[model samples]
Target: MSKKHRREEDDEHPDESWLLPYSDLMTLLLALFIVLYAASSVNISKLEELSHAFDNAFSSGINILDKNALIKATDEQNKHQQQRHEDVGARPNKEQLKQEEQENLENLKKKLDSYIKQNGLSTQLQTQLNQSQLLITIRDNALFPSGSADVKPDAQKLAVAIGQMLQSYPDYEVIVSGHTDNEPINTQEFASNWELSSKRAINFMKILLQNPAFDPKKFSAIGYGEYRPVDTNNTAEGRAKNRRVEVSILRKYTDTATDDTVLDAIAAQDQKDASTASP
Candidate 1:
């Protein structure tokens, strides 16, 4: 009678094994809720503690990655985005491009002036801005020996720097001109001032063109030997001033002149150097 009663009780109760998975599912849901609450509250210590506990309790085959890794990835992404934004902001637009030529010329002048001042090259180098162009005059001795067209080794850096600056506005026409005092010359390499000046201009231009960023089509070389004198040839100082190499960055649209002629724009400097040596 007892056995029959026990079997009837089992039939009415059904199998209880199905409750194991349901209870496990409830535990997993509870763990998820705990994790979400801890994470939302920024309680990293508590969240790590709960994660470890739940991992041990429900050790099937699951793992939560370290929060630091996720945080690091997010930080890197933000930095990259910021850098891209800065680059875009720094780039010139069409309106800025139209005005950049003038602004770039002015900024280049300032940079050159700073370099000249820092290096104490005031006597050997100077810059002039006129209606037609931007003129950079370098004394012959700065880039060459007494009568040689070869550029001085140390002065190559200056050429490279000027080239770099000019590359910023590559569309402008650049003229490298060589000048000489009234003194005559006769050598195996150069027969007269014309040849000497021409070689000097060509060599310097070659150095300037060494910069790959510079467009070769925008460059030209001229030899104004004993013709265009910024100072008189009567005195030693005047002669020294007359011998020079001129790098002129020509304006793209000039109604009048092609060269950087000393117009009234830079007349004050001429007046200042009057009866004196000028670059």
Candidate 2:
């Protein structure tokens, strides 16, 4: 009688081994469908994973039952791979940097030219771009008195404007060089042309450095005096041409081969100056 009573209790309980698994499968399917709805456009690999997940969720076969958590782990693994793909482990190469430097110098040249034209200082200011440097030549009379080193108050604006333009390119080496005609000067304030030229360069450089955006180590002042004359000293016109200050923006990158084009431009300019200066 006890055996029969136990049998009756077993029949009432009806083996519920599949119920738990079925409920878990239903939950996974519902979550997967929600994910699918959010990401309607999936790649081929994603579609394959979803299909495999659906097969497992439906209890389709015993073959894939051992790795039931394959889909759950796949998401994390794919995400890790994606992050690695997004990481660009490359930096700009030498040629790329050279190209960028060229473009920047060109742009700065254009800006300077526009500023010169707009300010009606074309006669006193000129720019030359070469493989070696970006040369800006300014007549001494524009920045100083007949024999003075002190910059005229109005000309400080030009210096400041140049300084502001240079702020955009801070890495370059800048040189403020003063030049003068062959005429010898022995004033109370200046003993010789050397003293006058040196002070002029120094004063102009000081004004530029006032912006504080520049690295002082990269800046320098040079005094060429009458040593580097681009024009003849015989005539008044040539002397006027020779007395100038030059702001040379030294180049960081150079071409593999030599470029004599800048020399040609200088020759052409000299011819022009000589023709105009001739009496």
Candidate 3:
């Protein structure tokens, strides 16, 4: 009877049921710790390689990563790479624009020189290149009478030829500058060289604008009037050299930052001088 009772009690009690899930949870926790340790202690080069491989696997349009976390990392890396590529491509366009502008200016200078040689006007007109722009110089003796601002009838022919050649180019800002030797002027029409230089510049500009092809907005007349001399005024030949007009064509879009800064400073100083001028 006792043995029968013990058998019944054994049937009622079975093996523990919770052990399977508990052991599985322990195993998963152990695996997570191992992965974390491997990530923290791996060699840097190896880590980079792993990261790259992971990126390729996930974002290569072939999602190989079984876990979702690695795919997000790959997306971030892809976005970063795309941004870098875009940033790198941005500068070449600016460089190309600068190159095009430089080539265009050089061509303009060449044309000016060719025209000067062909016309046999080398005695009165000359072309040159400097850091700033292409300069086509016209001697005062060729363009105007002594102490007079009027451009001679003969000089108008020369201006027409220049205007025709310059019409081919419409990009540049043209500055027409009139300069005179350091000499005092006493005349019925004008008491100062400044007035004479300014009037001469205006008349020359008018001649140039007569062509109708050269834009008036692109042109400006400035009188240096014995200032900014290219040669010494001590000798008659040097003074003659200094008494001249220059047509300067600017050759840059955004490349003339330094030149523009210098010009701004000069303009400001000129304004100050005019304000302080005595009557």
Best by lDDT: 2
TM-score winner between candidates 2 and 3: 2
List residue ranges in candidate 1 displaced over 4 A: 1-99, 255-279
- Taking the tens digit of each residue's C-alpha lDDT, what string does model 1 give over 85-164? 89999987755664666777788888888889999999999998765678999999999999999999988998998888
What lDDT does the true structure give each of the candidates?
0.81, 0.84, 0.78
Q: What is the lDDT of residue 154 in candidate 2?
A: 77
Highest TM-score: give the candidate number.
Answer: 2
TM-score of each: 0.58, 0.62, 0.60
TM for candidate 3 is 0.60
**Model 2, 1-279: lDDT tens per residue?**
999999999999999999999997786677767768845876666667667666765676433333547655476659855875666335666788888988999999999999999999999999998788899999988999999999999789999999999899999999999988878899899888898889999999999999989999999999877767778788888899889999999888776553466577677876775564454
Q: In angstroms, how far off is 165's CA in candidate 3? A: 1.1
Which candidate, 1 or 3, would have the higher lDDT against the true structure?
1
Model 3, 225: alpha-carbon shift in Å? 0.5
Question: Which scores higher on lDDT, 1 or 2?
Answer: 2
Candidate 2 displacement at residue 194 in angstroms: 1.2
Error of 2 at 176 (Å): 0.7
